[model samples]
Target: NITTDTLTIAGAGLISTAMSGDTLTISTTATADQNLWATFNADTGTTTANTTTDTLTVSGGTGISTSITGDILTITTPALLNVVEDGTPVLGGNLDVGASSLVKSTNVILSFSSGGEAAVNWTDISTALTGSGPIIRSVGADTNVDLVLDTKGTGDIDVSTNKIVNVVNPTANQDAATKNYVDTTTATTAQGTLADTALQNIVEDGSPQLGAQLDVAGNGLGDGTNLLLDFVEDASAVNHIEIENEATGSGPIIRAVGADTNIDLKLTPKGTGAISVADATNYETNVTADDDIPNKKFCDDTYAPLHDTINAQTGTTYTLVLTDDGKLVTMNNASANTLTIPTDASVAFPIGTRIDVMMIGVGVTTVTGDTGVTGCARLAEQGILIGRR
Candidate 1:
């Protein structure tokens, strides 16, 4: 019922409109400086558009792609993309950064743990390295951290065929010394010659011959406190002389040690020089002097009669041995007994040897001589007999 002029189609510069009979027709057409599609910014502000090409393009950014197949639009992401939103990224395989360095901002720690053991942490401490197990650590201050190298079990850090250079001179007794320090401090002369100043550096030498007299000065030839000198034979230590210093006591020992069983320590004086023993203050008991240093027994036997050593005999006939000199012989037989004194050829008795005889039983004692004997005596009871050789 509507007429052509009475019905109108409104188009907002995108389509053309008209009315035909009972049908209202609308068709898209290009307007002045107008296109179907327009390029917009991120803020939804329209920027520019092409009038001839009114295509809406769907492009992709890095690690992404888009494709349109018929009426389907597909967007694809990267295949190796393991990262999730606000989470740690874990790769299925090894992460290889091609030709790039993996940089860290702080100290790196390499942690290790066994079945029942605590975790061992090895940390990089900028200038030095440290371990939580303290197997190897830096000792000293931060600026001058002393590196300590340690081994576990039979493990060894072997620097094969490589020389350790730039080593500082050792200060302590057990410290490691460098070649330069050893060469400079040990010797200044040629091959076999050793300088006098280098004597302090030589700890031990096999068959070391002194070029001059060794002057020990006030320090002497010892460790200053104990063992003064040691003499060894073919790597076997035999004797050592020790000087025992006393704090407040008067007795200090110059001890000579013979480091073996049943060994004699002898001090031989140079020809005809007497061994002078000074300060004979104290008396010693149960001591046997090898030399003829007179003891109490010798003094009593020579000067007194109260301490004569007795040689007791029980048989009827007894022979006087060399040990019977200066000793009393007592015969204790029930009958008469004969004391036979052998000649100097059989029993060589020294000159002026004297022997005393006593009859202890109800018997008579007679002192008889052997084949070439000179002195003889007969006594009814007890008497003294002196023999001369």
Candidate 2:
């Protein structure tokens, strides 16, 4: 097998100036200024005389059997092509790779790998293939597999490969809260414009469902599920998000819940700080305490009693301890007895002053008044009791 050896040009990347199964060293040095070019095996160890600034040509190499005339090289044999690294073998006519030919292929399958360590990040390619943006699939008239610019439609020749084209029209009320999707469309729908707005703008554009809120769907749900226009309030404030787990061993599946966010929160009684009872103390919850109130309770101290009683006395007792204050009297005796109020040098009470008396013993207790004193105006008694002027 005649294998083509690549000649390394002085640069940062692996670029070949020429390749052939021969001992060839292609090197370069800095020239002040000029575009540099080279020909492969052009001389064949023997130089040809080109007297003027004219075209030079190279002859056959490896899998190609050719002869150079003027500036063009023509293949003289039906060639067998092979991809030296990892790519589809390209040729002038139809590529014959081993026993297979790309002339009448319905589709071509390709995979990218970088030394089994990383994936080949496709940037530049040979002249045979070209395109860009929004993963596209073009079903041409011939329908033989080809990724050409503007392959899907007569629109802009988008060269970006990482894009999605609307292959079918999305169904109504089927999902995405009824958002238009590129993969669901039946025509050349520019998906980047629709999805670039993000989920929020999409929801904000449409009317929400009856008593429903728009939320990002999380958990195992696909990107499409994020558009599930149904946002349900989980509790008082939490809203769940739907996304995929992307966990190993689980493969790539849509999860129904990712996480949540809180809306608003409220307190119980709607007051700041706390209200608590102090030890062995009560609070005047209705009003603020004043000087007369002092906020002190009976448990701390007590006041003097307001009522008093004197036992039976043998002699007549007329002068009351409180001369001006009103008094009521009740008497009890072993036998018939009376307590009398004598009149002499006694300061008369106010006109409204009245006395009352009662006898529990078997004796009459009458309330008799002196000449200056008025008789009992309102009194209840059983015996002659005394009243003063």
Candidate 2 lDDT score relative to the true structure? 0.41
Candidate with best lDDT? 1
**TM-score for all predictions?**
0.27, 0.17
**lDDT of model number 1:** 0.62
lDDT per residue, candidate 2, 1-389, as tens digits? 23777445343222223335654433333331222335332222322223365454556666557776676768876645545563554467954488773332323333222444443332222123456332334332343545444355556755387544444444566633223554233222332344443233435566423323435475433445424333346456344433344446664432333244433322235467643324324433422445334223432322111113434433333333334233446556545544445344554455444444556555444444454645442222444333322
* Per-model lDDT: 0.62, 0.41
lDDT of 1 by residue, 25-107 (tens): 54454333433445121122122334356577888999899999998989999777444563544578997989984544533
The number of clashing residue pairs in each candidate reads 0, 38
Off by over 4 Å in 1: 1-201, 204-210, 220-225, 234-241, 259-261, 278-389
